[model samples]
Target: MGILLLMARERVPRVMRGEIPMASIAVERDAYPLKARLLSNNFDNQFQLPVLFYVGALLAILFQPGWPEVVLAWLFVATRYVHAYIHVTHNRVGKRFMAYAAGLAVLALFWLWLILRLLILAPSI
Candidate 1:
């Protein structure tokens, strides 16, 4: 959630203030600005994908989804957070790509499931 990210950012400033004398935070101040920009860009993209997903979902509450679909959708949301975490924390490119791919797979599968359900059920109307 964006709120969670904001809360996390607030803690960093507080922690940095506490540790300035020791320079415990390893990251450079200038580098953080660029890192932050990349973070925001990813967050923006993540938010947009879910908005479009739910819009399709809203169009067809005629039949609510089963548990797996809902769970997978939630997994996509969690995976996005994981994607951002691996990217900024460990800086592991391979891990970041894996997280991102997992999220995309969930989204794409959810979309296809919703579309097929709607089309198959359309004959009843």
Candidate 2:
């Protein structure tokens, strides 16, 4: 969303300059296919993989896991920053994949820990 907003800010001048048609801003892809399009795609990405984070976080909070789980959650969020950096900047495929995989692994660990806490540890708690 921040990236989208920044892109929109940058685009205002282009729109005023008549470089990109106002009507074609959202719909017509072929008409405007470059920085603007990349920004839109990047914005769309926020909704894709991060949904897992939201679910994992909700479960973690509901279960009230220990500090280790909280650390793991923070690790996942850190990876997201790295992922976004790689995505918006250099955007190297291999680098981006590594960051994304790291985040996914952290998220998976978070879910695993939460599940264990719920099923195994919760009985004792």
Candidate 3:
């Protein structure tokens, strides 16, 4: 096992030098391909969903739940920033998905928690 691990480690630089199987979606030498263009569009769409949610949360806080709910909503938006960084900068695979999933989970939980809290705890005020 140790020998195999050492072999893998030795290959790491070679992989970075384009020896590895190309798992990248689409790539071109010195040119951004269609995949990169599509990813950019995807980045833009997902970039705003969480932010809009937080703006809703802020409105609810200043005018209508509690501070905690607002924080929860905003944190998800921040997570999307991390997601984009991973997806674009490093081209990392799993990390972007995890960050994206976390952001979505936070958004869903925020909405549910806010609605339930508003119904069960906070009265019309």
Candidate 4:
């Protein structure tokens, strides 16, 4: 969504400057290929480890989350936001990696908490 917004906002200037054709992106995706590639890569990154985060979130709900789970969830979200910011902006690989790693760590912790809650706290069905 953010990438789409960025692409839409970016089109105005590029179209004026004739960098990208004033046509459908589907027809001229490569008119300004580099930015397109960057946004595309960032969009693809969404499905990677974030898939795990989504699963963990759902499990957290099913397993009955408390303060620790809630805090870890917020941390994970913050890391994703940081990762996206660095990914789309300056795009320094090192910084992007750090943010990604942080998100991964928080996700791991979230899963761990969920597992413990399910095994130790949840009443058997």
Candidate 5:
């Protein structure tokens, strides 16, 4: 996504006008203008809660989750798509936050379910 963002930025004539050097962005958070900055921030956001999703997915694979877990996983991915759409587009905080919170809730439930499954399936000492 970061590479894609950089490629997209190159296509924008204004970004290529040399107003803000690309190098500056690495050193300064505010180097990119509003839209570019928002995109950068959104790209950075992919790493946050999604890291947990990756772990949960791995665990799910190892544990052989049922249909319910599969549904929750899809729901979580869907919410993230909605959140990123709102973030990079209109960027209405209220709506974006709702999507974010929904994803977080689903993620928490996913982890909880995984933990419970592990405990229930554990062998007796």
Candidate 6:
């Protein structure tokens, strides 16, 4: 959320500088042909895979997930940070995809562990 907020804040100055049109705020489409829309794109990207992260995190907190879960969560966060940096800077699709894939792998592992834990505890519940 902080990252998203920061991106939004940065957009204001860019808009004020006439890099982006005030009317462009109504939609996601970038009107500025010369300016890089890295922040806007990154902000949108946060809503995609990170939705799963939020769900997994809620479940983990509810179930008191183990150290592996915690570690995987941190790994996911780290990869996301890397992804954001790659996305907003060089905008290298290959490198950004790799970072995204790493985060997805971590998230998948975390989900697998969470599901297994739930299955194991289901009988007692």
lDDT of each candidate versus the true structure: 0.66, 0.79, 0.63, 0.80, 0.81, 0.83
Native RMSD of candidate 6 (Å): 2.7
Cα lDDT tens digits, model 2, 1-125, are 67878668767778888987878867665555466666666677778768988987887787766897889989988998888777777788899899989988988888888888888888797
Candidate 3 stretches with Cα past 4 Å from truth are 1-39, 51-55
The local lDDT score (0 to 100) that residue 19 gets in candidate 3 is: 51
Give residue 108's lDDT in candidate 3 (0 to 100). Answer: 78
Which window of 10 residues has the lowest lDDT sum in candidate 2? 28-37
Q: How far is 56's C-alpha from truth in model 1 (Å)? A: 3.8
Error of 3 at 19 (Å): 28
Q: Write the per-residue lDDT of candidate 6 for residues 50-109, one digit (tens) a residue.
A: 999999999999988789889999999999999998887787899999999999999999
Q: Runs in model 2 with CA error above 4 Å?
A: 28-30
Question: Which residue pairs in candidate 4 collide?
Answer: none
Model 3 has a clash total of 0
Best by lDDT: 6
Summed backbone clashes in each candidate are 0, 0, 0, 0, 0, 0
Mind giving the per-residue lDDT tens digits that candidate 4 earns over 1-125? Answer: 88768866765677777776567455645666666557767878989988998888888787667899899999998998899888877899999999999999988888887887788767752
Q: Write the per-residue lDDT of candidate 1 for residues 58-122, one digit (tens) a residue.
A: 65454777665678678877987798777656658899889878877888887777777678755
Candidate 5 lDDT tens digits, 28-67: 7576566776777777888999999999899888878877
Candidate 5, residue 46: the lDDT equals 89
lDDT of 1: 0.66
How well does candidate 5 match the true structure in TM-score terms? 0.82
Error of 3 at 117 (Å): 2.0
- Model 3 TM-score is 0.57
Q: Return the lDDT, model 6, position 112.
A: 91
Where does candidate 2 clash, by residue pair?
A: none
